[model samples]
Target: MPASLSVETAAPLASAADRLRQIAASTVRPDLLGRIDAASRTLADATVRVVVVGQFKQGKSSLVNALVAADVCPVDDIVATAVPTEVRWGQQVSAALVTTLTEDARTIRTPIAPDQLRRLVTERSGAPGAIGTLHAEVTLPRAALAGGLVLVDTPGVGRGNARAATNLTLLPDADAIVMVSDATQELTDPELRFLQQAAALCGRVTFVLSKHDLQHQWRSIHDADREHLADADVDARIIPTSAFLHSVALRDQTPGSRERSGIDQLAAHLQGPVRADVVTQRQLAAAEEIVAVGRLLAMVAQSELDVLLDPASGGVVVHDLERAQKTAEQLTQRSARWQQTLADGVEELIADVDFDLRDRLRKVGREAERLIDSSDPGRSWEQIGAWLADSVTQAVSDNFVWAHERSLHLAGVVADHFSLDGRAALPELSLAGTDQALRAVGGLDFIGSGRLGIGKKLMIGLKGSYGGVLMFGLMTSLAGMALVNPLSLAAGLVVGTFAYRQDAQTRLDGRRAEAKAAVRRLIDEAIFQVGKEARDRSISSKRVLREHFVGVGESFKQSLAESVRLAKRGADMPKPERQLRVERLTADLAELRALCEQAASFSTAHASVALRSAS
Candidate 1:
């Protein structure tokens, strides 16, 4: 019942969305606005995804089942969840198999018998083909699922690289993460690492210590885990739970058993703060959208109001509109100040990125050289190569991320140059394509593999020994000693060792040079690719702003023309008729102004609430 009733908690958000829809319809088309329709749909759908993730055999599935009061996810000691399982509210029990036909290009949903869910989700069943199933969505008429809460059971961490990647990728979309771990052990290193990444991506995470009933020392374990999380600087709440106990309590309807199981507290937290925050964010976003629409409407109304209240203001309005039109035209000119700023900014950005990359590679080269001087290249080259690849990848990602942030910041600067009042909202810029460009530069394959066959090492050693014998044996011959004498042998031994060391150092230096060259090539390629993208995005942003202002100028002109027509008509009308028309317009203006104030108040109130919650 709590779950069914939770849907009512989002009434404020729903009302806000409806109010925004009405405002958008009267002013701008709802479909024309970005993020408004999407926010509205989110409010309407009311789905909050809480993904349950953990290591294999950590009782994640059992925990999810207890939370939802449904045996939707398959649980076993040996077999594990291969595909994600989504459990949501439905009138009757039903299930669907969602299959991906092409990564994300297409998907096919097929209705399946609920009994087939376990087999399809398990790796042992092998139900998924080569192009595996994406996930299975199961629907049930449970109270917890009634408020549009979708519980996701993801494959455990530490399964494999593919599974780990999938888990990490899912974090960005999850509204909250319930990290399940057994009470028998403290958090492992890998789990801590995963938590750090998940915290970065999701922002809201809760640690669930499972199997509390089995582990008599769960309290100690929970405290230790809390300490561990604190030391690791992970800000998350930890709740100890016993899924088996919770399940029993639900089945038996035992008094106080629910509270003892700790599932009730977890559920309440999810239904209360988690759900409230989701709704509040959506409400605030919708309020902003409404306010944006109201601003535009108010601008038009104010123009009319000004003319009616003071007929002399009509000329001033027209002049302002004409000036706005001229400014919009200038925005498109190549010689505009903003265009020049963009050109200069991009040139500086490219130089900074190139310099930063080269500097990073130089450091890596120095480290590699130090290691080469200490050991044979064939022995430790693999480690050096791996380190270089990781370092370069991280450096490239950082540079690209920095470029993206800078590009957006620069776009704002350009917007300021175009704005007559210097307060106009800049068009939102998207540099998402730049990320793909950085990835296209590929990994450090040019660094070459460190795996050197024994045959190559042997040949190098033999060549060094041959040189040592030829040079040292001749020196000994000058001392009147046989070529095979002990003196010749001793000289050859020392020379051979020195030659071997020299050869290794030379090869190592050569490889290091090659690695540096490869890194430089990659950096240049990235600069060409990412620099072009930044330039294109800059141009695109300018065009978008230009078009937006151009539209605004047209709207202002039309409003002024209509105002002139109305004023002329009023001058010719009878006094009583003109008075009535003026009164009607006055009332409409008052109502529009009130609506604008209300939208602004909504934003302010929501913002205050958010600040309080954050604090």
Candidate 2:
């Protein structure tokens, strides 16, 4: 952060929480802000919302029924409980089943018995092609709520029933999904997508491979389940349970059999503050990221403002603001390329999977999954650095060219209108240089590579051709916004500012750090003119241009140092696709400069505001 843009001096740990508090007080973007606030508060309150998820008959309701020691959810042989029967501890004094709808709402306070529930909440269409469309909210006893953590029993997803189909919709709300994988069948793609989605929506998601005791050998199944968790990027705190084993214990109502069965143990673990803590953690993590960004932005802005006030500070502010704008432009452009990178990765993965490696013989009995998986799985850290550099290089180069061509004409128009070379230079003159520069940067930066990763995670391997063109097209809408008008470019960049949020658990820690750094970069760009930005300007320039230009050069140097640091960091990630993308970004940056120079050369004076951006 530049000296001019400096703001927050507080320690990092508590800052995010404070930022949230501040945001709560303000009404700006309250809807969006409130989501973060809710997430933050939920995290702080330490509440957990656990959902007992599985196929309809796979004992979902029965598990909740057994765990909560209540029959709140309608459970029967017909597999009814279709539209996500959420049995939670409601604020209402009495037990009630509230079904909120688009048009109206209804509540059933009477304890809904299994048989009666079947009649009231029958199957309906248009719900993932499931049987019912009613939202069932049941109230559980206080003990069951367990510190405000609600246990939702959703209709099993893989059962091909309408209930299971709706599982995707409800998965995001769950902190932990007890995936009661039928000890009988293999986990399907939908199940996998559910886990993937859960991981995306809620950072902390775990799975349960129920009916463990039903199998002859539990070790192999457990191992496979663990591996499955790894592939889906899910964290496994798996416990195998068999209601059948406990049936004997519960049948006689004997406490000993129940504890030995593990069902009681699993249920005990599920209904605790620990589960709520998981949900809270996810919310906190999101809040922390956003606050961190806001902090950096505020700090960077202060640094710029400081430079703006001190003429002695010279052009530092202008330099930094340009850099910040340029960097932002690059990020989005890199995001745009990620789709192709992912596609190429898929091709590479498929290629590798097709290979007949003989090394497996040295390590015998290796399964097909273990054999073909890439050594890097998803590109290694080293690969990431290389990828970024390549993308940046390419992006910079292209944008630079575009800028150079257009800048000459712009320079002629501005005609040194605000010449830095003279005392008569009108500081009041509003040159569009900064604004145009922002446009150049934002324009290319908006070409994001995010599509590929999103598709891989969300579309799964189920999507067919058309590039799933429709899905990609929706994302392309950002491009349209970037192209709208002058101010719209920056606004688009701000509004379209997206975090590449994914549920890849291991990568999450790293991804989070990257997001923070990205925010910092943006702030740095926004306040381009900083006293500290003159690191690159030849100190000897003092002889030629005096105070302002020299100071501008210094500020440019500071900004360059920061860019170099980012580039150096990018060196650690060496994936071919990322490397290619970074090169692309670099290219864009070069082109960006060329265009800016062109505009400068044409304008007899500074445009004052040059923005280069791609949304």
lDDT (tens digit, per residue) of candidate 2 on 58-154: 6677676666665555656663565566666655433333433312323324454444554555453223221113455666555657556677777
Cα deviation of 559, candidate 1, in Å = 8.6
Compare the candidates by lDDT and give the number of the best one: 1
Which candidate wins on TM-score? 1
Candidate 2 accuracy as lDDT: 0.43
In candidate 1, which residue ranges exceed 4 Å CA deviation?
1-45, 99-104, 124-133, 231-233, 252-257, 328-581, 610-615
User: Cα RMSDs of all predictions?
Assistant: 7.2, 30.6
TM-scores of the models, in the order given: 0.65, 0.41
> What's the lDDT for all of these models?
0.65, 0.43
Candidate 2: where is the Cα deviation over 4 Å? 1-16, 19-39, 45-47, 91-116, 122-133, 158-163, 182-237, 244-253, 268-287, 290-297, 304-311, 314-615
